[model samples]
Every structure is written in structure tokens, then in C-alpha cells.
Target: MKNVTIYTGPLCNFCDAAKRLLARNNVEYKEINIATVDGAMDEMITKANGKRTIPQIFFDDNHIGGYDDVRALEKENKLLELLK
Candidate 1:
């Protein structure tokens, strides 16, 4: 499986949902809480291409955006391919 990373914050339902989706798919991920870490939000923004949002996800080096974006990828049957 490819390495996954999620830049998240507390009290974010989207983040939780994204995590659940990844869990259901058995995609292990590294969760980075920006609220708890200094400079993390800046990194997330940079990685997300200036989209400052919670739950920014990455599969290997691919920025997968937020929960809705993730679900869309799964619906399109591309997520599994990325995981591989």
C-alpha cells in the first residue's frame, strides 16, 4: 500500500469522515493535526495548492483534497488504483 497523509484539525466532521473512508478501505494514514502543530497549516496549504481546508489528504505524493474529493475518487474507481 502507498503511504497516506491527512492534514486535519479538531472538531472537523469532514476529517473524521475522510478517516472513516480510508479506514473502511484499509488505507493506513499519517494524521497531522495542524491545530496542535505549528507551521502545519502552512504546509497543508502549500501541499493543497493554496486551498486552505481541513482534512487535506495525500496518497503517496498525490494530493487527494478533502472528504468529498476522496469520495469522488472512490466512486470513480481511481482510489484503489492509487492505493496500489
Candidate 2:
């Protein structure tokens, strides 16, 4: 499986939902909490191409976007392919 990363923040329902989706798919991920981690917010913004949002997801170094984006990919049955 490819490495997964998620840039998230506290009290974010979207982040929780995104995590749940990953869990359901049996995908392990590294969670970076911007609210508590120093410089995480700036890092997430840079990696997310200026999209300052919680649950910014990535597969390896490829940006997979936010929760809605990943959910859409799942719906299209493309997420697993990307993981591989």
C-alpha cells in the first residue's frame, strides 16, 4: 500500500469523516494536526496548493484533495487503484 497523509485540525467533522472513510477502506495514514503541530498549517497550505482546509489528503506525494474529493474518488472506484 502507498503511504497516505492527511493534514487536519481539531473539531473538524470533515477530517473525522475522511479518517473513517480511510479506516473503512483499510488504508493506514499519517495524521498531521495543524492546530497542535507547529508549522503544520503552513506546510499543509503549501502542499495543498494554497487550499487551506482540513483533511487535505495525499497518496504518496500526490495530492488527492479534501474529504469530498476523496469520497468522490471512492465512489468512482478509483481510490484503490491510486493506492496501488
Candidate 3:
């Protein structure tokens, strides 16, 4: 499986939702809390192409965007393939 990373912040519903979705699929991920990690917020913004949102996810080196974007991939049946 590809390495999954999620950039998140405190009190974010989208982040929780995204995590639940991944858990349901048995996907393991590294979670980076921007509120607690130094310079993580800036790294997330850069990786997300300037989108300043919580739950910016990446599958390996490829950016999968936020919760809605990742959910869209799941809805379209492409998320698992991407992970593979």
C-alpha cells in the first residue's frame, strides 16, 4: 500500500470524516496535526497548492486533496486503486 499522509487540525469534522473513511477501508495513515506541529501548516499549504484547509491528504507523493476530494475518489471507485 502507498504511504498515506493526512494534514489535519484540531476540531475539524472533515478530518474526522476522512479518517473514518480510511479506517473503514483498512488504510493506515500518518496524521500530522498542524496546530501542534511546527511548520506543518505551511507544508500542507504548499503541498495542497495553496489550499489552506485541514485534512489535506497525500497518497505517497501525490496529493489527493481534502475530505471531499478524497471522498469523490472513493465514490468514483478510484481511491483504492490509487492507494495500490
> Which candidate has the highest TM-score of all?
2
Candidate 1: worst 10 consecutive residues by lDDT? 57-66
Would you estimate the TM-scores of all the predictions? 0.94, 0.97, 0.96
- Given candidate 1, what's the lDDT at residue 64? 80
**Model 3, span 1-84: residue lDDT tens:** 999999999999999999999999889999999999999999999888998988999999889899999899889998899999
What's the distance in Å from true for residue 5, model 3? 0.3
Residue-level lDDT of model 2, residues 1-84, one tens digit each, is: 899999999899999999999999999999999999999999989998999978899999999899999999999999889999
Model 2 TM-score relative to the real fold: 0.97
- Stretches of candidate 3 above 4 Å error? none
What TM-score should be assigned to candidate 3?
Answer: 0.96
Off by over 4 Å in 2: none
Q: lDDT score of model 1?
A: 0.92
Total backbone collisions for each predicted model: 0, 0, 0
- Candidate 3 — worst ten consecutive residues by lDDT sum? 45-54
Error of 1 at 59 (Å): 1.0
Better of 1 and 2 by TM-score: 2
